[model samples]
Target: MTRHLIYLSIMAAFTACGDGGKAPVQQDTVIAATGGPDTLNRMVLIPGGSFSMGADDSTGMPDEYPKHTVRVDSFWMDEHEVTNREFAAFVAATGYVTTAEKPISKEELMASLPPGSPEPDSSMLAAGALVFTPPHHRVPLNDVSQWWSFIAGASWRHPEGPGSDIKGREDHPVTQVSYLDAQAYAQWAGKRLPTEAEWEYAARGGLSNQLYPWGSEALTTGVAKANTWNGHFPYDTTTTDGFTATAPVKSYRPNGYQLYDMAGNVWEWVSDLYDVNYYAQVGNGTANPAGPAKGYDPEDPGQQKHVIRGGSYMCSDEYCRGYRVSARMKTTPESGLANLGFRCVRSVANHGQ
Candidate 1:
């Protein structure tokens, strides 16, 4: 993610599939709601099944190639991405401090920077995270610095920077959350992040072989099903889906599983450590695959990476089509950005189902 590059370069910054073509008659319907003890968690029961896990579509990025079959056990997933209000409740209960709220440590700085690099200025060591700042004019997309800035005091509470606050956006998906921060919230709630396989399966909403959770429909048509960039991406956006940035978590229709915001709104943090080649190594029809034991990103080999599913509002047909179900992206576990957020999942084992 470009959002993490600038932050990590200075502070040790950071960090799907399918279908046919139709929604299965039975599977497309949401699983019957169970009044389990975790019902208050507001989770949707995803009755799992086998599905292809990567992009067979040529438009997909290289990492999404070699589509493969995978099986994931049924699990309960948050109905939507974790929102500011929900995260606030977690913070109030646990007094948990997010990674973005903590200043960079000397040890972490030294490990990330090149051995010969000079010591960083004290001012750059403040507590903050990355915030998106669109350039006034068109700029080369290759250099993301033109559109991203690392700001001090830019944590989940201050998604846009020092003066910005999430005050009126309580129902919007929480942003600027690092992987550890999301994991902490999950642990506190007795939940865990979903595995990439589980995530893709859920996102499909029982629709097999479709290009999106919504089926084979083109993204450019109809009442915008998800929040994605409607114009020239980084340079411009029409906000056609009624959001220039993160929208309220359920701003659009739910997927077959009754899961909202599965295609866009924000990129979601999942539990799996990323590996471009892991799909190739796993045998077909593999059940309950947890992803590679370790993480690796060819682009940033030295940094440990985790998979982030779905796409954010910044994605557009002309620039990034990451909103696609099979698309994959990774970032440093510690990197936080205004466009990244997450939801939690709990295995069926947790409640003895």
Candidate 2:
């Protein structure tokens, strides 16, 4: 099962870069307001501050350990995850194509596989993004492939595949977006993806050493917090938060910094390239750390991945406590999953503010 996950990750990396018919061209037009009135209307100014960046408790993953002090300059952050409506505007204006929309190349696919790996059938090589399909019965948590399927023709427009559409869910956070897709959107919007340190700082809001964006309270405790699985993972969701999948942005209360959906709804992409040993190498009092120059994941050494924070609706204490503020996850930059999305940020200087 674990091997299957690694193979899928590698395949996604190459498949996402597959060439579609469109020729690559740069867009000179900037659609977003550059430090104009609309800037504050859409983004919040996070004050500069210092805080402990990682987890020190038992909940911390090996990569999140060796909690270190970090500092960041003030920046402007999107109020919530990027929405389908916003993404559609970018696509319509820029005529941009997302990774999942491209076709897979056999050469790229073969290179991604392990040595002597069997060539995938033509049908299996069809371009698509991974979708989370829950099982009818309880399944072992060890094998994630049981719930995740690479469905052909699945893209941001058709989130659930062929027949699905965004339609009235314009306010919902856009899914099936690869890191490259997010980067393109940011470039068009005159902003950039947040650094891992910036993301954690903003997610922490004004609080410090907290387990969640809201506080130390358990996800299931008190009133329903962020959107998360209820009953069990992979199967049987009680919908305690009134959502079984991605919820509309701002469905829950905002954090101290007035950032919405900073904990769940969907995992957000940060600018940092992932490195399992990054935290250990980070010295104390590091300011505006941009993360390691390259990504290194021992499990999938061949695949370059980036850090993704803010777990999605599928997160739960039962199987994956990814919703925790300090929790971390990584995937190939080109891998677009139904549970993944991103937001943008701008440095104060970049914003010309």
- TM-score versus the correct structure, for each prediction: 0.89, 0.91
lDDT of 2 at 137: 92
Cα deviation at 232, candidate 2, in Å, is: 1.0
Please provide, for model 2 over 309-342, each residue's C-alpha lDDT reduced to its tens digit, 9 standing for 90 to 100: 9998998888777888888999877788898999
Predicted structure 1: lDDT: 0.78
Candidate 2 residue-wise lDDT at 324: 81
lDDT of each: 0.78, 0.81
- Candidate 1 per-residue lDDT over residues 118-203, each given as its tens digit: 56556556777778889768887766677787788778878887788777787789898888888888877788999999999999
Indicate the TM-score of model 2. Answer: 0.91
TM-score of 1: 0.89
Task: Tell how far residue 123 is off in model 1, in angstroms.
Answer: 2.1
